[model samples]
Target: MLFDAGTWSLITDVLAAVFILAGAFLTFAAGIGALRFPSLLARMHAVTKPQVLGLILLLIGLSLRVRSWSAVAMLALVVAFQLLTAPVGAHLVSRAGFRTGKVDESELQPNQMEPDDDEHTA
Candidate 1:
């Protein structure tokens, strides 16, 4: 009985710790990417992608440690809201960056953003 209960608790703690550490690592990577990347789009991608996933992982770890339904539910909502907005916010920021002429046009593909000549023709 002691082994079963105590071991299970220990396992849970270890797993939660792993998740937390991994989440921290992901967030750290995101920060590094945001700082190191040259282009606006690249920087935006770096800041958002891993950051969102890291937030999710961090929330998961918090939920596991709490082990409460209410806490988990709140965390789920947080994750949901983050997931819904992160991409959209990133999109807006990138678009703004592009429109502001901060992004290098040379970084884009040859045909990138080229209007469809056929579409405009009668």
Candidate 2:
């Protein structure tokens, strides 16, 4: 046989466990940020960045355990779509939140906000 079933099984399990734990941690952090953040924009930042990454990690880990080229390819496609969309979606949501005055500017650094038009007086 080209492979030892028992050893390979153990290795696969270990890898899966590690991936799951990391994904769980990332998701947990996102949840905490969402709950603890002072504004919608901050919460959006948490979800769009860490949550997306966590999901990608979880999907990749599951694909590795599947050990099939097709599955990995599908997972890669999903990850690619997520990478392309999550940030854009988050940006739209943040802009909506800002326009709606749902965000609290006091929590953010002053420099992060654009200079006021009144401040640009000639």
Among these predictions, the greatest lDDT belongs to: 1
In order, candidate lDDTs are 0.92, 0.86
- Stretches of candidate 1 exceeding 4 Å from the true structure: 1-3, 110-122
lDDT of 2 by residue, 1-122 (tens): 86699888878878887887888889899999999986788789888788998988798679868889999999999999999999999999898888898877777677757788888995
Tens digits of per-residue lDDT for model 1, 1-122? 55797788788788889889999999999999999998999999999999999999998988888889999999999999999999999999999999999999988878767888897895
lDDT of 1 at 109: 77
Q: What is the lDDT of residue 118 in candidate 1?
A: 90
**What's the TM-score of each model vs. the native?**
0.86, 0.78
Among these predictions, the greatest TM-score belongs to 1
| Candidate 2 ranges with C-alpha deviation above 4 Å | 1-5, 106-122
Query: Candidate 2 clashing pairs?
Result: none
